[model samples]
Target chain A: MAIRDDFEVVASQVRTVVQRFALGLLVIAAFGAMLVGKADTVLVEHARVLALDVVSPVLEAIARPVAYANRAIADLREFASLREENARLREENARLLAWQTAARRLENENEGLRSLARFREGPEASFITARLVGDSVSAYMRGALLNVGRRVGVAPGQAVVTGEGLAGRIAEVGENSSRVLFVTDVNSRLPVLVERTRERAILAGDNSPRLRLTLLPSIAGVQTGDRIITSGHGGSFPVGIPVGEVVETSDGSVRVRPFTDFSRLEFVRVVDYGVTGLVGTGAAAPAPATPPGGTAVRSR
Target chain B: MRVDGTLAILDRWGRAALPGTVLLFFVLLTLAPLRAPYLSDTLPLLPVLVVFQFSLAAPERLPGPLLLAMGILLDLLLGGPGAPVGVSALGFVLVRAAVMSNRRYLVGVPFLFQWAGFCILCWGFVALVWAFTTLWTWALIDPVPAILQYVVVVVIYPLIAPLLARVRARDPLNVPELSRGSARPGETTP
Candidate 1:
């Protein structure tokens, strides 16, 4: 019995010492990993991609039942608000009909003018729709993992949009999954312009619900209701895609509200607009697509 | 007789592995895309809480290396290029080390005391993550989301604490029974 007690005491002492030692070593390793992540992004990105691929199946399986449940709840809510929604849609549809007629007339006139001036047609955008599989709800980041990747021609730097408008751009692409860096992430910076005034500015995210416009000319007038669109200056995203609307301009700071409700994002379209200029994720952009006209056109 | 011995060894190993399996389940749960208003913005730190509870309850079962792996998994699963990797790992180790030091006070105490200890520790954990993230990105992240997450995690700790306790209770090592006689004044064997 005494021998057993001594052995137990020695084991306990060893465990205490080892725990203390491990704590220190782990702390050091954690810090070292942070440094390594910064210094070698490719290695970290590859690892993250592998991790995403492994978890994609599990998250996808869970997403189905959760999505159906959410849809069922939404249907219940819709049933309760059916009358109000019907009245609103009727009023909006009538107003849109008048605008549609005017827009058709303008389109005819614009097409004639373009022919007279021999205007080159811009590249047509093609898209692949993907389902949302994962969400990064961390306080410091705003990103989403999608269920499609390179196999579906979904590459980094492609513009991801919902039914409403621009949501974000693909940051990393794995074999079976990809991550989208939302326009509201602190690291996201896009060249955009005011549709009404044609004043170019950089849209910056501060990891907040609302994004801010930076690098706007000091003398340019920006109103709260002005529509913001991608300027196509950086070639990261296709030009003229609706981004957001200016919501606030207070004390020289301008805040824009994105049209897409990120919290409610279920599905998004990853668009390839044939602009191969922005080579994000250290991967070369795919060759631009050839236009049928035989004219030199970019393709991806 | 040999088969009985083998089965006994397997049972012991399975009992030891229960906490880890539960922790991994919570990690996957946290990563799932359940987008409901506040939940879409800030997920409850379920995995973090598990690490804390196990470290307090039985550190030997969830050692520093496993905690480190959990943190790295969180970082990878977060899938945000904006946030650097290892931030979660760092938080996990920091929390584990801190909780291990206070295990005596936290364990074998009234549940309220343990809850209170977690309430205080969570603040420090969230703040450390915020500070480290800011230094890494070199930007001032709005503290609102972090504060919201902290509030959510702290509020839900009590509801989840019992489940974590039950997991510890299943250990074949009979941890509480072994330590019951050695329990000091005002401490109850859990």
Candidate 2:
């Protein structure tokens, strides 16, 4: 009995020592991984995509129920305000009817002019609707994982949008899953034009709900509610896609609130305008056309 | 007699593996699409709480290698351009280190005291992650979101701690440690 007790104690001590050594090694390995991730972005990105692909199926299964639950909750809320919503929709429908008639007239005139000039058409825009399987949107990162990827021709840099307007663009693609980098992420920089004034600027995200407009023309005037749209300078997104409206303009800094409701995002349409300029095919991003009185910025 | 011994060994191994397995599940839970405004940002910290609870409950079972794997997996799931990937692994190790250093006092303390210790340590971990992120990006990051996440975690801790404590109480190894005639609880071995 005495010998057995001694053996157990020795074994315990040895185990303790081994555990300590392992803890030290793991701490070092963690630090090493951090350094490697910083140095080699491609490796990290590949690993991230692979991980997403592996987890997406499971996320998809979970998303269905969660999406249903969210819809139910929204429905309950909407039911409480049904009368107000119906009245507002009725008013908006009447306004849209008048605009629809004007739009039809303009389309007819534009089509006649195009044929008379023999104007060549740009690459046709195509779309694939995908369900959102995962959401990584946070204060630091704004991204969503989709169930569609290269298998469905969902390439990187394709514009992602909802019925309302622009949401984001594809940042990474795997076999069955892809990631959308939202317009609100710090790394996202988009070329936009103030629709009313036709003045160009760079819309930059700083990991905030509102995006900031940078590189604005010094002489250009912008208002608080000026509409913003893709300038089509960058071939990644189509021209004139409604992005957002300027919510605030103070001290020469303008903030935009995107039309897409990020919190309630469930389904998104990925648009392929067939222009794989910078992100998709490794071609250089085109520089924004410099209007007079403004320096041009690269649309990246 | 041999069969009884085999069953005993299997039970011990199963118990040893439980905490790590549950922690892994918590990691997966973080990625689930439970969409709400500001939810994705705050839910990432759920695994951190799991790590803390398991580190206190069964430090031996929840070893460094498993924590490293869990953190790296979470990093891979969350990582993207401009996002720190392996920093999560570093954070896990740091949390483990913090808990290990204070294990003796924490395991012996009352529930309230343990709760308080957890609050302090969780805040410290959040601050450390914020600092690392700011440094990695070399830009000034707004601290409000991280602080809000910390607040949410603290509020949710009470609901989670008792459940983890129950798991600890049911652990077979826990009884042996208590009966080892140690002056305080959880001081049998480091």
- Docking verdict class for candidate 2: medium
Find the 10 residues in a row with the least total lDDT in model 1 chain B.
B174-183
For model 2, the stretches where C-alpha displacement exceeds 4 angstroms are A1-18, A280-300, B1-14, B169-190
Write candidate 2's Cα lDDT for B12-126 as tens digits: 7787788888887777667777866555667888888888887777666777778888888888887556556767777788788788777666775688878888889888778
| Model 1 per-residue lDDT tens digits across residues A1-300 | 999999999999999997558877898888888888877766887888898899889989988888898889889999999999999999999999999999999999999999999999878889999999878667877888899998988878788998888998887889999988888987677778799999878888887889999888863499888999887775646788899999999988999999999877899999988774444342222225422211111121
- What clash count goes with each model? 5, 0
Compose the digit string of candidate 2's lDDT tens values, residues A149-203: 9998988778899998899888888999998888888767788899999998888
Clashing pairs in 1: A287-A299, A288-A299, A288-A300, A289-A299, A289-A300
> Docking category for candidate 1?
medium
What's the interface RMS deviation of candidate 2? 2.7
For model 1, what is the C-alpha lDDT against the true structure? 0.78
